[model samples]
Target: MYRIELDRDVCISSGKCVAESPETFRFDSDEIVELVPGAPRLPDEEIFDLARDCPSGAIRVFEGDEEIDVH
Candidate 1:
């Protein structure tokens, strides 16, 4: 299983993360991105893509002991 974390303070609401993986990330009525608990269960490659594509670098994904930094 993969775990996701979002830095609400650093998020700029660019929506790139949502666009890249809608199932994984979404925007609330206020336009803040919300990460679903277990959605967007992407493969390792997609997780990396999401990290690389996030413009604000606010998203972080973790697998076991490994942590992926996503912006």
Candidate 2:
């Protein structure tokens, strides 16, 4: 399975990730982006898209330790 991570220190909270995939991403009380704990499994393409859409480059996807990217 894949893992999702959000670095709030770098996130700008543009809401693009939430708008693209609310099922797996959301905004915290502080307006920073966060992963939805226990979220349903998402396709690799969608996950990559979410990471690509994050303006601040805060979202990271991994299969173990290897980071994922759109290209």
Identify the candidate with maximal lDDT. Answer: 2
lDDT value for model 2:
0.84
lDDT (Cα, tens digit) per residue for candidate 1, span 1-71: 76667788878999888877888788888889997766746787777777777777777778787885554
Name the best candidate (by TM-score).
2
For each candidate in the order shown, give its overall lDDT on alpha carbons. 0.77, 0.84
The number of clashing residue pairs in model 2 is: 0
lDDT of 2 by residue, 1-71 (tens): 77778888999989998988888788889988888888898888888887887788898888899887744
Cα lDDT for residue 62, candidate 2: 88
Runs with alpha carbons beyond 4 Å of true place in candidate 2: none
